[model samples]
Target: MIGIATFLYIYGYKYICKAILTAKVMFMNNLNAPFPLLQSNKVKFISSFSFGFFVFVFLYIFQPFGINEVQFYKPLFIGGYALITFSCVAFSFFGLPLLFKNTFNPDKWTVKKAALYTSFIILIISVGNWYYTATIGQEVISLKHSFLKFIGITFSVGIFPTVIFLIFTEKTLRKVNESKAGNITKQIHTDLEIEEEKQENDIIPQIDFLADNNSIPLNQLNFLCIKSEGNYLEVFFFIDGKLNKSVIRYPLKKAFEQVNELNNIHHCHRSFIANFDQIEKVSGNARNYELHLRNLTFTIPVSRGFSKDLIAIYK
Candidate 1:
């Protein structure tokens, strides 16, 4: 009786650990952002049973002690083991969706509610285990002690793996937030350079408004920066800064050449060109800068290579 009880306890404990470690590896493989874990209920169930069976057979074959008791009806023992393993695996696999649903929509389960749910799940598993043993007519080696041992095995195998998964998910979220912050800083820097260029242009003396035979003033044209749908650039101009702008489609380099003639054009970033006269202030540290304009704010970043030029403009 003592040997049988010890065997069952050891077998159950090791099987539980194997199942949990397998689940953890599966969770890690499926960590593909926004979908942290896979939704394959069938795979999870199969994996659990396979892990349990593998661990059980490995332990039985490599019996550390000399307590090998040959029993008749060996097939019955194997079948019973398979049935128990499948039941445990299926229960865990089906329950996983509930965990994910709670994680994705936190509003569904408050801390208190989660605690209550977890307790209910544990209770169900414990009662189910007892009922299963009773129906099979298997007497526990030491009922009082084995019950506590079973609880320990279940927690170590199941709950510990879930906790580890939660930790990994939190780390992923932090990385995402850091990436967004970097993009925001870059945008702010671009807007600042545009404002600064506009201000510089305002200080320049107004040139004579030369009118062609059509009475269109060439010197009074307004400047605009237009981003193309893809790799094109278009510069728009409005005469007297009040008329509707006229667009000239050209490569960005060519547009830069035309703007250079006016003495106020600057490349804010690879993606933006700015008129410096509109710059209000350069805020934040040297690594990042904010450009404030009339009712708009943009970011301009000063790389180590461009820092000198940025400072020269401000000075």
Candidate 2:
């Protein structure tokens, strides 16, 4: 019986430890997920104001914390709490972003950082709420005690609904985008088959290629591809059957504008203009499309916005 009890106790302890670890990991993951960036100060202010308004309305309706017991000046009392919430939200959304730029960045954002930063905001808000009520409202409560209470209030009212909405909206948007991309991908592939037979490059006349205001006779060289590197453009072409690369001090748009009027020369991506005749292959999933030009090792991307135009070029 003693041995059995010991084993049971050990088993229970291990299970609890494992459960705790799993919860911790899940919490971390939730913190790091991608979240939408609050783009402008105007948006931040509006969001804060909206949240404060919500809290005020909810408090007035629900009358929690015995606000109903107060006969006169009840709205005034609740309004003060609303102002606290607004102030806290404003401080968090406006001020914290500048401090946690990378964490709140749309591209690099993760659930983990958002959660941590949100908790930080909640902490500040909880403190503010507690301090306000204790000092002004004259509620006698410890900061530590008020913190948890305020956090619970904020979470129940704001965070929970926002989280649910974000999750549902994100899933729906992803599904729709993926489906749309898939259709576009299929259509692009069909177009690619027809495009294979088109010989649009034949009519292209040799034009001088510009590099730092210096022009090289493009007719002398077999053009392959042109891609952008920030302020400069990299020109890929063949000279005497040997592949050569030249750096031109020009943006992709400017460089391509000069060449796009020519047959088969097209802007495929934000950073790339490709010669269709030189394209060896095109392949990618719905999210992205890549063009493989002849005599080139790397692939060039095709933007979704330009996908229809690219397909139209073949027709």
The sequence of per-residue lDDT tens digits that candidate 1 reaches over residues 78-133 is: 34544554565556557655766655342232334434444554454555544554
Residue 150 C-alpha lDDT in model 1: 46
CA-lDDT, candidates in order: 0.46, 0.69
C-alpha RMSD (angstroms) for model 2: 12.8
User: What's model 1's TM-score?
Assistant: 0.30
Best TM-score among the predictions, by candidate number: 2
- The model with the greatest lDDT is 2
In angstroms, the error of model 1 at 176 is 4.9
Q: Worst ten-residue run, lDDT, model 2?
A: 138-147
The number of clashing residue pairs in each candidate reads 25, 8
